[model samples]
Target: MFLKSVFLVYSLLVLRVYAANIMGLSPFKMSVIQPLLSSSKNSQIDCDHHSVKSSKRWDVVDMLKAMAKIDSTVGYEYEVMHWLRDVLEEQGMTVEMQLVEDEHQSVTGLARHNIYAYMGKTRDTSIVVSSHIDTNPEGNIPYHEIGEEIHVRGACDAKGPAAGQIVAFFELWDASIIKEGDVSLLFVIGEEYNGIGMKTAVESLNATWSKAAIFGEPTENKLSKGHKGNFRFDVEAWGKKSHSGYPELGFSAIEFYLRKANTLLNAELPYSPVLGPTTVNIGTIHGGVAANIIPDYVKAEMYIRVADDIEKVKAYVEELFNTEHSQMTIVQYLKPQYLSFDVPGFELIACAYATDIPYFESIDVKKYLYGPGSISVAHTQAEFVTVTDLYDSVIGYKNLITYNL
Candidate 1:
């Protein structure tokens, strides 16, 4: 008994050293385990030891701060990818980089890559946690702290959720509760402009048998039932240019755009009880060279938040455009995406914004959309996320993964 006790003490000391060195915990924080060794009950000592170790296994705040400081704007995620790769490798995960061709390679002359990390045995029934690594092109925005919030361009949009997902992954890995091939993490690019990265992943990765996939987006920590579809187009008008004073002498392209805009704004669109009514935004309009000159050409960009069948919506838009004289060119269209939420304790909502969900339609997996923060502030200059939300998401993701597994 005496020898057994001594060996157990020595083993615990070794574990403490390993946790301090390998787990990135400060020596001061590692000292919390010293008290557990003095307890008489072996089970109590083990429980206390695990509690201390888990608390210091990964620093959620530091990880989030590091991620927020990096500039991962769309088409420019190379540097951030390197940093993320190193972080995942340090946690003892097997990392894989999949090349993604840049659609703008003709202009930028460069390519990018997506990251995948996993452990344990590979299986078709693995759970996937995914999020985009790119942010809106907000330039070099620094992270700022205000009360309980952290302000940065991508903080609310996706980086916050990404960081939270990483922390949760680390927790599961450290606990050894999940075996290899049970869970995988994916970080993709091009979510802001297009879903090219996700599309590539669905094609390249053998993930068709995945049982469930959690897509991290800013959902204010609620589980989304689904989100609306998207359809975008450009309207162009052409007319003869003339002096503004003699407007009747030349047809005004600007006047044509205004008339069309008025008709679109007042037109009633189809509505759904589950997904809500279709909404439209005439996002941009440009015409005229000068105030004194009648414009020869004008173009307006519009996006529709589609609620139901995208084909029917397209037909409706086509009929509407046919009634007008302007030329309409379709840019992009995506059908509505519905997600699953078997895990309990979340309020369900239908998101109005679109995500990369539609891009993974070919992958035969149960999809889920969730995360921290809010979409309302995602692309705004004042974008921010609560530090509390970031921490809570770590727990939320862990629960989702645990439940699915």
Candidate 2:
């Protein structure tokens, strides 16, 4: 029969394109993520739990529900970065901490900190505000097929832009119009696992390169200026365990690590002008050793994202894994996806997503990147963020540092 009626109309057109990607996250992208997952502890959104900040748009919705009940997640961000450095040292500003670690996430290589606060440094360019208080334990893994609903877990990809960059860092230094030693504030932690607390905070606080470095996440504020830099690795592949009915003396390493990541993902990159072009994401893959045997040794982990000649896109991914898997080998090459901060006149954004600006794309910063919820309601279980976009991003970070210092 016409190829089983053309594979039953191509499996009902792949089940109607996976039910339109689950109706595009439904009209409920943020109806207040299920009443903030019902945590009202006895209901009181307006009934008067001190009527949440009583006004000023209900005190920016009770300060974004007290900074999403502070659960920084990822290897637990030092008690929400010491409750946001005790609310930036209760405004007087002048906090500093950097513990760094020996491994990362817990072999003892963790305990990150870079809570800086400044007020006067006049000019000579310098601005380095960053973000990544981590969160992504995913939880709720009931597995579904492509309807795109990967619920909860740093919901909008960054605690709703770290609760609109901590109310735009106290509406930019408590309205004193951010004093300006060119400006600085960087909070980071494993950026969800492998930024290794912003690479041990720019090599242990020789923080340097600061003419610009704004890198907060929840983007809806509209000034990300640019993103697209990462280059993780790991792809073994050997093979020789045998059994499964003599499969050519065994050899599969996840089928030669998916044919060397589908040949550099079918090649073609190099482009940017507004941080465009470049991306890849195999994410993970490991070896096997069961179901009738025949495994050998596999390993895979991929991540790519760079715009404009990332060393010719990493030498075209090592010449497409040395010509599509000649038994593969690159065990872990990292360090090729940069962005280590960049700024000069400021106002630039493209961030396809991923921050700590590729660990400061080489420094020299003047960074700019506004914040304040609507990353479509981060960490949804009804996660929230609209105390009027956290007091309009604390009056739009005090009018973007009083219109850029």
Candidate 3:
């Protein structure tokens, strides 16, 4: 135990000194790295303290575990951003924090930041690797290993991919494979919610930073050829409220909402030969104050996976849900995104989930989606990724970056 603590403390000190010397920052006065080092009791020496001297297969496992332990759900990505900034800076990379505050914060009341890093001071690069630093709103699950599989919230969804990307950058830097402004790493926030972080990045950052981009998501180590788009909307029904004993005097909002919801759900939607049939999910429904009283208002939140054109899907919904006593308000929508798998030797598949891919449409760069773990178990209590898969992705990401370079 003592030896491990000594190693942990020593690694941080060495990194602090190296970062200070490289970035011209003040020498070691306790930074964000200290908190992570002290909190991560099981953290291993993934990289050499002085320099990147090792590229062990399981180096990312400990790091991923530590990152998964941090609760960076949706609006709460500030701490994770700070930790990633410190790590990147310590590795002699230039880091910046882009605040993603806008009108949305009035409701969430929490401001989040995105971490962007690159070699040297220049922002221009030939290749870029990116991933979301935030997970779903589900509370943080304790990190634990069950045989080769590790169970933890955000393990498969993104933190696992994020950790792999970080290590891949380190490996590339250590081997001198990439130089100043050769590549950039972008970790965005709010991908699980509204994709505001990515929008802000695209709007604020230099669009010409890179010619190619590698986006990390849970693709089961496969390179995605395409992924379905999405549209979110809410259905609200209003009715007269009255006592249940005299039900004839009042109309039930819940009953009206159910009827509309059922009709809309039963309607046939668009389909695609490659992306499959358009699907809809009634994610949430809330109404009624008590069983004895008729509910005056009811709302149902719905999400649609767009396998076909986004406009067609919207038209179908708007046409089908037209009614007198109900209102259908569109919340958010993203067109189905397609990408190239031109790089040889990778398995290709289509994903149903939406990512921040579409937001970069204006960049005019070749986009590739690749990562470790399975999306099948991403948001559930059983969310997990195997140590083997996580480590393999580290090498995979390094190779992808090499290809772009």
Residue 247 of model 3 has an lDDT of 83
lDDT value, candidate 1, whole model: 0.77
Local distance difference test, each candidate: 0.77, 0.54, 0.79
The residue-by-residue lDDT of candidate 2 on 1-405, one tens digit each, is: 999999987776565454323322222222211112222532321221211111122133333334344555677566567656655555445667776652353654446564655544432235656677676665422212223222234534565455555556555555555555656666777676577777777876664644456566665555665566566666666667888898887776667768768877877777677677777888677778687887777777777766666667767676666543343344222332334223233343356555555555566545566565445445444443343444555555545545545
Best of the candidates, lDDT: 3
Can you tell me which runs of candidate 3 are displaced by over 4 Å? 1-58, 102-109
> In model 2, what is the error at residue 283, expressed in angstroms?
6.8
Worst 10 residues of 2 by lDDT: 48-57
Clashes of each: 6, 35, 0
Across 148-168, the per-residue lDDT of candidate 1 in tens digits comes to: 988877887788899889889
Residues 1-405, candidate 3: write the lDDT tens digits: 999999998987887776544322344332525222223422332211212221232258756865676678788776667766766676677888887874366356666788888876778788878999899876666666789998988898898898899888888878889888788899999898889889999998763555788999999999998898979898888889999999889999899888767876787777877788888899999999999999989888899999877898888778766567777888778998889788878888889888999998878788999888999989888889998898899988987888878
Instruction: Write out the backbone clash pairs for model 3.
Output: none
Q: What ranges in model 1 sit over 4 Å off?
A: 1-57, 102-106, 120-125, 138-140, 322-325
Off by over 4 Å in 2: 1-53, 56-65, 70-134, 138-164, 168-213, 217-229, 232-250, 254-283, 287-291, 295-299, 303-313, 320-365, 368-404
* lDDT of model 2 at position 242: 81
RMSD (CA, Å), candidate 2 to true, equals 21.2
Could you tell me every candidate's TM-score relative to the true structure? 0.81, 0.33, 0.84
